[model samples]
Target: MKLSTNYLGTVYQFSTLKEVLAKANEEKSGDRLAGIAAETVQERIAAKEVLSNIMLGDIRENPLLNPEEDEVSRIIEGQVNERIYQSIKNWSVSELREYILHDDTTGEDLKRLSIGLNSEMIAAVAKIMSNLDLVHAANKIEILTKCNITIGQKGTLASRLQPNHPTDNVEGMIASLKEGLAYGIGDAVIGINPVDDSVESVKRLLHATHDFIQEWQIPSQNCVLAHVTAQMKAIKQGAPADMIFQSIAGTEAANRSFGITASMLEEANQLAKVHGTGTGPQRLYFETGQGSELSAEAHFGIDQMTLEARNYGFARFFDPFIVNTVVGFIGPEYLYNSKQVIRAGLEDHFMGKMHNIPMGVDICYTNHIKADQNDIEDLGVLLTAAGVNFIIATPMGDDCMLNYQSMSYHDVATLRQTLNKKPAPLFEEWLEKMGIFENGKLSKIAGDPTIFTR
Candidate 1:
C-alpha cells in the first residue's frame, strides 16, 4: 500500500517502512551528523519497524473504523508513523535548530515529530531552542497564547480564572474573580465548571461574569462549564457567549461518555460563531486529559499519550480558541506519579502545539497522587519554557470544586517575574491604563480591599 500526506509544509510519500528508513539514512549521511554510531542508526531503524507494526494493529482495531475507510486509514497511519519515526530518529541538534530558525514546518508536522520523540529528547531539544523559536513554532501551528483569542501571534504568558462555588452562587463566584483579578491573574479568560449544569444556574453565572467584565471593563472572555446545548440555551436567553467549554476524548465512545458527539460539537461551533463575543474568529474552549479513554473503556489497546494526541485532531476541527489538556488532573489511576505526570504533560503540550492548537495545561495533581507543588512547579516552568499558551491559576494552587492542586496566582506571578513575561496584550494594556502595571512590571497592589465586603 502507498500513502501520501503533507507535513511541515512538505509533502511526503511512503510505500513501506523501509522507504521512510531509507530517507532517514539519506539525511543522516548527507548531513554527516556527528556522534551517531552505526549501531544507533540500525537500532533506530528497528524501532521504526516496531512502531509501524504497532500503528498498523491500532488502525485495524480502531473502534471508529468503517469497512469502507479502514484500509485507507490503516495505510495512512502506517505511513504517518513511519515518517514520524524517521523524522525524529535522524534529527541532529543542529538540524532541529535550523528547522526552528528557517524551516516552514507547521504545527501538524511538529506534533507528529513530537509524538514520535520521548520526554528526554523533548527536554534536550527544548534546551537548544530559543524562546522566539518556541513561540514561532507555536504560531506555525496557530496556537493562541493570549487570552484575548488572538491567533498566529506571540505575547506574554496567559492564565485562566477558575472560581468554583458550591451551590453555583453568583456572589461567591464574583468574590473569587475579584480576588484573582486583583492579583493580576485571569487576564487570559475567566472560565468556571458550574457545580450545576442546569441552564438557569449556568445562565446566572454567565450573566454575572459578563456583567462583571463590563462593569470593571475587564479585557477577557467568560465561559460556563456546562454542556454546549445548555450554554446555547443560556446564550439565547441573553447570557454572554464569550466561550463554550466541553471535555473531549479521542474515540467516539469516550466522547459519548461526556454526552458529546461530533454533530453536537458542530452545532455548538455554529452557535458560537453566530453569537460572536471575543476578538477573534475562534470561540470553542475544550479540555482533554490522558486517562479519559481508559476511564470510559475506549482505549482500544493504544497508549494513553497517543490517544490524547488523537483527541487534539478532533479538537482542531473546531478551530478552538483554547485546547487545554488537564494533565495530571485525572488521578493516579491514569498517570502513576510525578514522573509520569510530567512526561505526559510535556507530551500533551508538544502534541497540541505541534497541531497549532491554542494549548494550555492544568498542571495539577489529585489527592490520590504522590505528587506535590514542587512537581507542578517543575512541569509548569518546563512548559513555559516550551511556550505553552497558558495554565490554570487558582488560589494557592488548590481547586475547591475540582479537588485538585493546580498552578496558583503566586505561581503565575513567579513565572512572569522569573521569565520576564507579561500578560496578554489587551489585558496588559488595560492593566497599564488602570495603573496596575507600569513599564512592563506589575505594581504591588494590595489585595482587593472590598473583597471581604463583597
Candidate 2:
C-alpha cells in the first residue's frame, strides 16, 4: 500500500500499517511514550490522509496483530460477516466515514453496517474524525441491552451507582447506596470496585447490594468488580450476582496479565447465565480503557486507540449487558492532560458505538493527571448528548476506595434534567413510585436518603 503522503510540500512516510495507525492518532502521551506517535502535527495529518485513502479490505487483510498469534485478533476475525464484508470491502475509509455521517443513514443502517466492520476499520475511521464528528455520528445510533432492566433506550441515560468503601464496610457502602438511590441513580447497575478481591469480600458486597435492591424493590442490577476468578468462585458459593464483572484488554498478552482468557470469560458468562440473579440473555459486564495493554507491558507495538477498539470486538462475542471505557483513569502517561482526556473520551465512546456494543464510559481521571472533576463533568454532558447508555457515578464524584473522581450522583440528576433526558424507563417508574422523581424533575424529597428508612 502507498504509505507516503505530502503535507505542505513535506514528504511523510510510515513503514507499516501499525505505524500509520499509530502516527495518525490524535496526540496522546501514551503513543508518544511508546515512541509511536508522529513527531509533528503536519506529519500526523499526512498519516491521516494516507489512512483515509486505504480500503477497508486492505485493513482487514493486513492485520496489525496476526490472528494466528493473538486470540483477540482471531476472535475478531472469526466473527466477521463475510457476505456483508465482501460488499463493503472495496470502500475507502473516507467513504465509510461519509456514509455513516450521511443524513439518510439511519440507526438501523448503522447497526447492519457494524456487522461488516472489524476493530481496525472502526479505529481507522475514528482516527480521521473530528471531535464533533465523533459526537454527531455516535449520536445517530442507539444500542440497548438488558440485564435486570433495559438500558440505552433513546432519550434515556443511565448511571452505575458506585458506592465504594475502603474497607469493604457494608454499612458505609449502604449509606452511599441509599444516597445514590435518593437522586434516582443506579438504573444501569449498583457496581462496586471492592478494596478486597477475595471471594468472601466480593460475595459480601454482592449480597449486600442485592439485598438492598430486593428491600427497596429497586429496578437495577448488582455487581462486584473483582477478578473474574473470584467472582466465579463467589457465584459457585451462591453469592447473589446480577452479572459477572471483569476488566478486559485488547491483546491476548494483556488479558493474560489480567489473568483472563477467552475461555475463562466464556466460562464465567455461562455460569452467570445459569446461576446469577439477573433475568436475561445478557449478563456480562466488561470495563476497558485506553493504555491498559501498555501498562501491562503487552501493547505489542500498536497504538492504544486501536487496542481499545479491539476490546469491544472481543466483548461482542458474549453479548454483554454493559461495556464501558474507564477513559482517563490510567493516569497522564497515557492521556497527558484534560485536552487529551476529553478527546480520548469522545473517541472511545464513538468507537464503542461503532462496534455495536451497549457502551458506557467511566468519565474519570486520577489526581496525578492534569484533570479535575470539572473536566469529567464536561465529558459527562457531552456523552449524554451523544446518547451514551450510561456513566459511572460516585458519591459527590469521589471514589474513596478507588481514589479517583467520577461524575457525582447529583451530576446524573442534573444531566438528565439539563438535556431533557430521563432515566431508564423502568428506573423512572420506580423513581416515581418512591416519590423521588415527579413531573419530570426531582421532587422535594429527592435528595433525602432517610426516605428509604421509612
Candidate 3:
C-alpha cells in the first residue's frame, strides 16, 4: 500500500497514502517525495512474500527453525526428568538430614526471571534485525530497526504499535490496522481489550485507541499482534496465595519484560504530562490460566488493573504465558514466565551455596516457540542439538529425565551433548544473545559456568 505522511502535531510526522500517491503522480514529482515513492514501489513488489513470512512467525534467516521448535520440547523433558531424578536421588538426603539436625548443604535459590530478552534490549535486536532487514527497508527507516540500541530509552527511541483485536477476529485486526495506517502507524499494531470491569470502560478504551491512531495518521507496519486480557476466576480456591505469589513473580516479570522499569513508567508519565496527555494511560494486567491452573476472578482482577492503567495512558502486558516468553503483549517478549519466576526465586534462595547463581538458569530451547504440548520433546531435542540455552519448561510436560525404556536415540544424544557443555549454556547463551558479558556478571547463567550446576 502507498503510505502518506503528515506532521502529527507534536507527536510524529508520517507519510500519508493520499499525499504520497498524489505526489508520486505529480508533474515530474518533487525531490523530497522521490525517496518515499521509490520505497513504496519496492514494498509493493515484495509485500506479499514478506507478509507471509511474518504470519508464519517462524522465519529464521538461518534454517534455524530446527532449533526454536525442536529444542524447546526436548529441553523441557530433560528438566522434568532431572527433577524426578533429583527427587529420587535426594530422597535419602531427607532422612539423613533429619538425623543430622542441621542441613549440610543449601538448596538452590531463585533470582528474578533469568534474563531473557527484554524491551531494554530491543535496540540492539532492532539493529541486528535491521542489518538483516527483518522489517522492510523503507519501513525500517522510521525507527531503530538499525544498529545497536541502548537500553531503557536512551538516545534511541521505540516506535510504539498496538495490536488490533476488535472482538478477536481477522477482520477486526485488519480494520484496526487499516484505520491505524490512516493514522500513521510506523512499526506495529498492539491489540488491546477495551472491555474491563464495566462495559463503558471497554467502549472508551476501544474508541480511544482508535482515536489515537486516527489522530497520528501515518502508515508503516511491524510487530502486529493482539492484546488479550480476560476476566476470569478460579472455581476451587483457598485464598490462592500460592498462585498469587506465582502471579506476583509473573506480574513483576511482565513489568520488566515490557522494558518497563519503575523509572520508565514514571518517565513516560512525566513525558505525557509535560506533553499535556491529560493524565497518561495507566494500564496494568494480572496473570490468569485455564483448566485448574487459574480462577476466573483472578483473571478479572488482572483485567481491572490493566483497565485502570489505560485510563492514564498506560498499557498492560498480559497474555497466555505457556512458556513465559512474554509473547503477544506490549510488555516483555522474554517468555518463560512461570518457570523463569520460580527459577529466579530458587536461584536467589541458593545464592551462596550454588556459587551464587540465580535460581533461574537458562535451558537450551532450539530458539522456537511451542504451538502445543506435544511438540515439547521435539523442541527440546532440537535445542540440545543446536545448543540454544535456557530451555524453560512447558505447563504440562514430563520432566527431562532419560526414561531408559522410553527414551529415544535423539533424546539420549541431546542429553549427552548437553551434559558435555556444562556448567550450562542457558546462562552463557542468554548472556551472549542478550549482549551481557562475563565481566563480573553474577547470575547463575552469568560469570563462570563452573560455579553453576544442575
Candidate 4:
C-alpha cells in the first residue's frame, strides 16, 4: 500500500498495513500512530478482514473508541498496573508508611507506577494506608492537601486569580481584581497575561496588581504573565516580583520558542528571591501541558504524555511555587476531544504529583473543541479527589483574552463544598476575619451574584 504519514512532524513510510500495525504495537508507540494505523487499515481492508484480524490476533480494541468503563479497565490492567499493585501489595502497612515517608526513591517510583492506575485505584490505595502514612505520602508527593502558604498572614488553599485582559489595560485589570477579590478568590496569586508584551506594559500591570493587593490589604500575591526577560526588566524597574511566570516545555528548543533558557529561569528565581514575595516555598510560577513539545515540533518521536512528564523534570529545577498543566488550552490539535483531554489532564496531574512537584491543573478547553463545562467539572472533581494542589479560577470560567473556558470562581466554591475543602490556611483566616467566611462556611458575600455582575 505504501502508506506514509506524519506523526509529530516525522514521516514514517510503511509498505503495507501490516507493517503500520506492527509499528503501532511497538513499545512506547504513540496513540496518534495507533489511531493512524486503525484508520488506514479500515480504509484499505474489507470489514470482514479487519474483523477477522481483530478476532484472531492479540490486537485489542482502541481504548479511545470504546466506552469509558472499558477504557478505564484497560488502563488499570495494563503494564504499569500490576507493577503498582505489586509494589504496594508487597509492603506491609508500616513498611509502606516508612517507604512513602522517608524513602524518596520508592516514593517517586510509586508515583511513576500510579501513572497507569485510575483515580479509583489511587483512592483505594489511599484508603488502605493509615492517616499518618497518607499525610506523609501526600507531602512527599507535594500534594497541597492541607499545607497552607502564608499569604496575608492567613492560611488558604493555594489558588490563582487568572484575570486575562484583552488590551493589557490597567483599569480593566483592576476591574477583574475587584470582581475576583469580592468573591473570596485569588488566594494563591492574582496573575494576568498582558495583551501587550512590552516592558512598560508589563511594568504597569505589575505595579497596578501590587498596588491593588496593598491598598485593599488583600493577602494574595500578583504577577504579570510576560516573558522571563520582560519580567526581569519589570523587576529591575522596581516592580513587585511576586511570582515570575513562564510557559515551559519538555525540550530545550521548545522552551526556546517561549524565550526561556535554564539560565534565564535560574536568574528569575534568584531575582524573585531578592525582590518578590517570599510567601511560599518557591518563587517561580510555571505552566505546562501535554503535546506542547510535539506542537512545538520538538517531541523527538516521544509520546505527548511522556514528553509532558519530562517537562516536569525541567520545571522541578526551579523549585516552583506552582506548576499547572494547562491541559486543554492548547486546543484540539493535540488533545482532540473530551476523552483525550480528561485522560491527559489526569496523567499530567498524576505525574506531577508523583514527581513531588507542586502540581495544579488549569481544567480548560477551547471553544473550537467538543468539550464543555460538564467535562471540566468531571475532570476537576477527579483531580480534587487526587489531591491536586490548585486550579485556575477565572471569571465565569471563560477568559475573553485567552479565548478559553476554565474553572470559574463558582466552580472552585462548588468543589470545596462538594469535598468539604477550604482555602489555604492563612487566606481562610483572612476570609473569616473579613466576614467573608463564617464558622468555616461561605458568608453572604461569597453568594452575592452582584459581584460577578458588577
Candidate 5:
C-alpha cells in the first residue's frame, strides 16, 4: 500500500475569532501580539468573532488536512478545547459529560468529574465534519485514538493507562474513542515506542501494532518517531552520533526498532485495510541532524527504498514536505525551583499549527527527569539555542504544562516563556512581517511567531 495521503484536494480551516474584528473593515489587527488582551473575561464575544475570522484556507498548510503521508491521513491533531459547548463533537456526547465539569486542579476521581466541551467549538467542528461528505464517508471514516501507556508521573495520561494499560490508556480509552467517533475522528494514532533498530522485533511489533489498530471500532494508523538515540547522545557528547546509529556494532535494540518499522510497512500490505490507512508504500520520517541526523547515505538509502516501493516518498530522505515534524510539550516532571539547559531542535519544526499531512514536530523529552524551573528554563534556552520549534501543552493553558495535562494551553507556550525570559522579541511585529499584503497576494497567517524565533 503506497501511503499517499498528500493534499491533492482542498480542505477547510480558519483563524480564531479574535482575529476577525481587528481585521474587519481592514481595521489594523496591529500585530499577532496585539490580539492578546492579557485576560479572556468575555468568551462569548470570542465565539461570534470566530465566525467572522473563520474563512477558507488551504489544507497544504493545515496539519489536520489528510496528507499524502499515511501517518498524516490517519492521525487526529489538535489541543483540546473546553471553552465551547460545541467542542462536544470533538468528544463523544456521553464521554463529554464524564469529565466536562471537573476543575483542572481537582487532580483525581476522573470518572466522577465533568470536563465540559466547548460547545461552540464542537459546533464549528461539526459544521466542518458535515461538509466533509459525512453522508458518504461517515461509516467508512472510523474515528479512534490510542494513547501511549508510558508517560510522565502517576497522575498524567500515561499513568492513567498504567498496569495492564501500559501500552495504551484504558481509563479514558472508551471515552476518547467515542469522542473521535462523535467528532468524526478517522483514527487514533498508536505510536510504536523504542523503535529498537532490529529487523526481527520490528517485524513482530508491526504485526502487533497493526493488529491493535484493526481491533478498534474506527480506522487507525500507527506512528513511529524516528528517534536517533545515538545521534542524541553524540550531540550531547559533541561527537559523531550518526556513526553509532549507522555503524551500530552491537546495538540490538536499535536494530529491532528499524526492523519492526520496516515490517510494519511490509505487513500493511497483507493486513486488512482497517488497520493502516494506505495501501501501496508507507512514508517514513527521518530526523535531521549531522552529528546526529542520519547521514546523507542513510537518508538516501531510505528514500531510495521508498521510491523503489512505489514513489510514496520518505521524509528527510529528501526535502521534507513543507509540513511534517516530531514535536511534543513537557510539563515540569517535578515542582522544583531550579532550572537546566534547554534546546530547540529545529527552525522549521514547530507546534501550535497544523498542516496537510500532519505537519509539525515529533518530540521526546531529554531533561524531563525532574528538572528545576531554572533547569527547565535552561532547557528552553538550550532548545532555543538548538533551534527547536514545537512544544505541546495542556488544553486550557494550565501550570501542569504539557506533561500532566493540567489545563495546559498551547504547547507553543514554551516558546513564549522562553522568548519572554531571554530576548525582547517584537513577536507581534514579527508576526506581521510575513502576513501583510505582499503585493496583491496576502500571506496566510501561520503558526505562532514564537515557534520560529529560536
Candidate 6:
C-alpha cells in the first residue's frame, strides 16, 4: 500500500509499481534509453527500499501488464499454485530474499518457494540481491532437464555447439561441429543459428547435425534456430529434429513482433511431442534476453530485468528442455558494457533457475559493445560457478554468421577442467569412448576435427 521510502534524510515516493520496478534496477542503458531509470543513486536505493518492503500479494494483485491484455501475464498467473500463494502471500520481498539466502534453506525449499511466487516477486527480490547473492542463491538450486541426454546435474556443465555459417554452408558448419565435439562440447545440444530461416534450410541443417549424431552415435541433441513456424513446417514434413527452438519475449506485443503467440507455441509443443526425435517430453528450447521487450516497444514502461523474469515465467509453462538468455548479444544499448552484461547474465541465470527452468547463458557480446572475448570469458566462469546448466559456444568464440563473440570450445573444456566439472553423463561416456576425453580430461587426440573425419 505504501510506495514511499525514507533513506538518508530524504523521502522518495514512486507513483506506480512500474516506476518503482524500473527505478530499483541497477543502471542499464536500456532502461535509461526507455527513460525510466532512476535519476540518481539515492533515488535508486530508495526505490529498492520501497520495493523490498512491498508485499507479494500486492505485486500479484497489481499486475503490471493486465492479464486481460497480455497472454504472458495470463500464463504466469495460471502457473502460480493457489495454495502455495496463500501460504506466502503476506511475505515481503526482502523477507523472501533473505529466506532464500539463509543457510538453513534447502534446494527443495527454494523449489517450493518458486511455486508460491510469480515473476514480479522473483524480479523484485533480484533487484535487491548483490551479484554474489544471486550466485549463492542460485547455486543452491539444481534444475535438471532431459532431451536426448540429461543436463544440469550437480558437478556437470554442458555446452551447446553453435556452428553457424555465413551462407548456410553445411560443410562449414560441420567443420566447427566436429572441432567442438572433439573438445567434449555439444552435450547440451548441437544447435545452429541459421543464416536461412526457411523450412528447407532448417531441415537441411537439422538433418546434417542429426545424421552426424547418428553416425557417431553421439549422446546429444540437435536444433536449428529458425523461426518456430519454419521449424514446425520442417518437422511436419519429416525433418529429423531432436528439439524445436524459438526466441521468446516477455509481452504479447513483443511476441507478435517475433511472430509467435501462446496458442502457436502450444501447437509447436504438441507437434514436437509427436514428431520430435528427442527421447522425452521436454523438447522445447527457448532463448530470452533482457532488452527484447523494450526493443519491440512492448515493455509498457517496465524495466528490462522484470521483463526478463517474465520470459522465464512464460518459458516454464511449456516445460522446456533448455532455456538460455543471450545476455549480451543485444549489444551495448541494452547492457552497456562488461559490468552490465555480467550483472544481467547472473540475474538471468538466477531468475531462470528460480523459475525452475533449465537455465543456460550465452556469455556473449557484440563487437561494438565495448566488450571483448575476455569479458564474456569472465562471465562464462561466473555462470559456471553458479551451476549454470549450459553455455553457448562458437568456434574460437567467433560466430561469423551472427557477428558476435561467445564462449568458445576451448573455453568449455577449460571451464570443465578448471572447475572439476564434466559434460552431461552420456556425452561424457561417448567422449571417453571416442578418446576425446580420458580420466576426466581431454585426450591427446582432443581438439582435432580430423578425429571425427575418420
Question: How close is every model to the real structure, measured as TM-score?
Answer: 0.74, 0.99, 0.20, 0.71, 0.26, 0.99
Model 1 ranges off by over 4 Å: 1-49, 52-142, 145-155, 449-454
The TM-score obtained by model 1 is: 0.74
Candidate 6: list runs displaced more than 4 Å.
none
lDDT of 5: 0.24
lDDT tens digits by residue: candidate 4, 59-142: 122221122433222322343345555445433323433444566555456666544433322322332343334434543453
Error of 4 at 170 (Å): 2.1
Question: What are the per-residue Cα lDDT tens digits for candidate 6 across 1-454?
Answer: 7999889999998999999999999999999999999999999999999999999999999999999999999999999999999999999999999899999998889998898889999999999999999989999999999888899999999999998999999999999999999899999999999988999999999999989999999999999999999999999999999899999999999999999998999999899989999996689999999999999989999999999999999999999999999999998899999999999999999999999999999999998898888888888888989999999889988889999888889999999999999999888989999999888789999999999867
Q: Cα deviation in Å at residue 364, candidate 6?
A: 0.4
CA error at residue 49 for candidate 1, angstroms = 7.7
Each model's lDDT comes to 0.66, 0.94, 0.23, 0.63, 0.24, 0.93
Lowest summed lDDT window (length 10), candidate 4:
56-65
How many pairs in model 1 have backbone atoms within 3 A of each other, for residues 3 or more apart or on separate chains, i.e. clashes?
Answer: 2
Q: Flag regions of model 2 displaced more than 4 Å.
A: none
**lDDT of residue 81 for candidate 6:** 94
Which stretch of 10 consecutive residues in model 2 shows the poorest summed lDDT? 372-381
Candidates 1 and 3 compared by TM-score, better number: 1
lDDT, residue 196, model 3: 32
lDDT of 3 by residue, 1-454 (tens): 2222222232212243222222222111111222322235433323222221221111111121122433221222222223323332222212322221223321211111111111111111121121112111111111111111111111111122233242434444444444322221212122332223233333334344445434533221121111211111110111110000012221323333333333443443333234321221222222221111011121111211111111111111211111111211111122223232222212111211111111111222222322223233443333233322122221112222211111122232234344443212222233333232233132333222222122
What residue pairs clash in candidate 1, if any at all?
A: 107-354, 141-356
lDDT of 1 at 346: 71
